[model samples]
Target chain A: MISFFNVSKVYPNGVKALQGVSLQIEKGEFVFIVGPSGAGKSTLIKLIFREELPTKGQIYINGRSILRMKRRDVPYLRRQIGMVFQDFRLLPDRTVYENVAFAMQVVGAKRSEIKKRVPEVLKMVGLEKRMDDYPLQLSGGEQQRTAIARALVNNPSTIIADEPTGNLDINTSWEIMECFQEINDKGTTIIIATHAKEIVDSMRQRVIGLERGKIVRDEHRGVYANATT
Target chain B: MSTGVYMQMLLLRQAYYIFQEVGRSLIRNSLLNFAAVGTTAISLFVLGVGVLLVINTNEIAKTIESDIEIMVYMRHNLAEEDALTLEPLIDNISGVQETTFISRDEALKSLVKQFGDEVEESVGEENPLPDTIKVKISDPREVNKIAAEIEDLPGVESVRYGGQDFVKKLFSLTNWVRIIGLLLITLLGFCGIFLIATTTRLTIFARRREINIMKYVGATDWFVRWPFLLEGIILGFFGALLAVGVLYFSYGALIAKIQETISFLPLVNSSAVLFRIFEGLLAIGIVMGAVGSTFSVRRYLRV
Candidate 1:
């Protein structure tokens, strides 16, 4: 579970990105953080990862206040939260298998555990047949799936997808969303930051809408509200 | 298996992977790796020659130190027993190589032979020169101690030895050679580090998307750091080995030719000394490789 209490962030240049925002995201929940181009959507995700600190207020992940967490403790926090980007971010030179294996190897996982986990996760993403293929050889959707497999290999409690389908076609975008939904159903919290109005409207999941760094509306079944609001 | 064996196996695997990665990357960027290896070889060769010169100069100084002599002049009334007893005691000193006792007649004859016609006719039947004991020291620095002890001996009139000015000069020369060698090697090492750092940075830059992805997937700093660090270390170790090996062979050949040309001269035996120097060079190469990679990787890992 993640919680934010009156969290505010002011950049070094004195631009306030978030203003006293408070929200609670429970375990096994699927939510979308939607906003216009500059409406603190990225800031909110960065806060959860502790990549950027709040200027004021407390932020908690699993009941631990991360605002005062040390630099050395950041990795452990990251291990609990998996992240995916719009760009597939698969290593061009590494095979799909090596890329997935790398994620586990970095955490000092045992060889036997890695051997078992990597293939299992690749199979989960339906990329078991393409394990030896490099990222360049795979299609855009397949590459994103490979990335998602890498994320799932660690079994993170929360999966943060920042514009995961921004570059995919409409059909492929839905396919990616389906993958996220399946993972969320399996008891992992999912927070996807996107501007895809159709995606948010189609899911009818919890939606937190942002405008000019302020939460204007939040609904359990929000519509594709216009940014003109 | 025991814990020790497990750890050993783990380390061996890590080492193997590190080298495999290095070899693969080197082949991928063969041109750049070659440039790095060439630069290291030239720098090491210059550093090696400087070290050789310093070693040979020190050997020369040792030879000069052993040949230095001091003379103790005895009084005209010195007794045979006292003089005989003094000879044994002086010979027992640590630095005393050997000693020759000369009587007045023998001293006069040596002076006549040295001065030639001038002393031959001027010195009549009676000898004018005092009998002195000439002492050779194994170490020149101990000359002063021997002279002081001899001066305090019974029937000793005066003790004379050459000034320490020559020995001090030799020491300064040898020290200068060492400083030059150290400075050249340090400068070469710095160059090697810069090259490795730049190479590693470029390699990282080329695969930046991969790094960005790793960051998204929640890779730790060290997790992100390992492959790049390993990459640099591999580059450094191989470059150093190549440079050191080439220098050993080429320098060995050169030294052999020089020895053959001047076998009559008491030049330092390059054959025996080269092995010791080759070992030292190998150690320097490893350090340079390791250190160069470390400096190169630290900056890129900042993110």
Candidate 2:
């Protein structure tokens, strides 16, 4: 679980990305943070990862104050949470298998451990047959699946993605969402920041809307647009 | 296995992985790597030549310095015996190695011996040359100081040890060579570092996405640093080897062909000295590479 207490972030060049916004995300919840471009959606997610600290306020994850975390503990902090990006960010030269195994290798897992975990995660993402295929050789959905597999390989407690389907078509976007839904069913906390209006409307999950760095709505089973507000 | 041993084993395996990564990167970006290595070799080679020049010039200066003898001329009005008595005073000076008294007639005799008896016939009865003492110094660097002390002595008119201007010129040529050589070498070192750093920065820039993925996946900054550091050292090693190889053989050949022409100038001929220089150049090249990599890779390894 993560909590932000009156967090406000003002960038160095006098840009206010987020201001006085506070929220709590419990364990095993699927939440979508929705907004147009430059609305602090990405900035809020970045604060969770501690990539950029909140300019003023405290953030806590799992009852520990992430705001007070020391610099050397950053890797251990990141290791507990998986991250996916819009770009997929896979090493173009590596195979699907190597790309996933790379995550385990970076955290110093033994070869035997990597060998066992990589295949299991790849199979879970439905990419077991394309283990040796390169990223350029895969479809958009398959590549996103590979990215998800890599994010999941390290067994993070929560998986946060930023615009994961931004580059995909409608069909491909739905498939990627289904992939997230399947992941969510496994009881992992899933937080996605997206601009996909139809997917948010149809999925009917918890939705938090932001406009100009302030959260205006938070509701369970919410629609993309509020019918009455 | 014990825990310590197991940890050591794991670290060894990790080091091997880093080395493999370095090899893969080097081959993956061969053209850019070749350019970095080429610049390192050329800069270090020029540096090696500068060092050798400094060493040889110092040796030449020392040989010439030791051979110089100061002539302390007696006053024209002084009796030859009175001037001869001043030889002990000249010899007593602290840096004065030895002094020999030469009467005017002996000076004339040597001159006559050189120019034949016609010089004695043209001079008639009187020898125009004054009685003088030839003074040798213990340390060439102390010549000016010793000459001043000898000039203040009674019965001494002037000291001529190669004109004052000639000695000043020689000192400038020898002493300034070292300071100038050091400055040039330092500048060349910066050039080599800049080349390596720029090249490594380009490669780091190209693979930034990979680095971002590594950071997101919980890879420590050191895990990313290991490969780049090794790649830099490898580039540096090959460059230094090339420079040392060229300098060693070329210096040996130069000595063989030119030693007789400048027989008195020590010429830095010994293999021991050359090997020492080669070792220094190799060490310098490797340090330059390591420093270059450290500077460029730090910005990309935030985590």
The residue-by-residue lDDT of candidate 1 on A136-159, one tens digit each, is 898889999998998888999999
Docking class of 2: medium
Clash number for model 2? 0
Question: Could you tell me which residue pairs clash in candidate 2?
Answer: none
> What 10-residue stretch in candidate 2 chain B is worst by lDDT?
B257-266
What DockQ does each candidate score versus the true complex, computed on alpha carbons? 0.39, 0.60
* True-structure lDDT of candidate 2: 0.89
Give the per-residue lDDT digits (tens) of candidate 2, residues A14-53.
Answer: 9999999999999999999998899899999889888999
lDDT of each: 0.78, 0.89
The candidate that wins on DockQ is 2
Give the top-scoring candidate (lDDT).
2
Tens digits of per-residue lDDT for model 1 on B1-303? 998987676656555544665567767877776776666666666767777776777777777676689988887777655676678888887778899988777777777777796886777666666777889988777777878987887788898888888877777887787788678777866776677667666766766666665565555665566666666656555665666677677766866787789654344555667777666666665566556656655554443
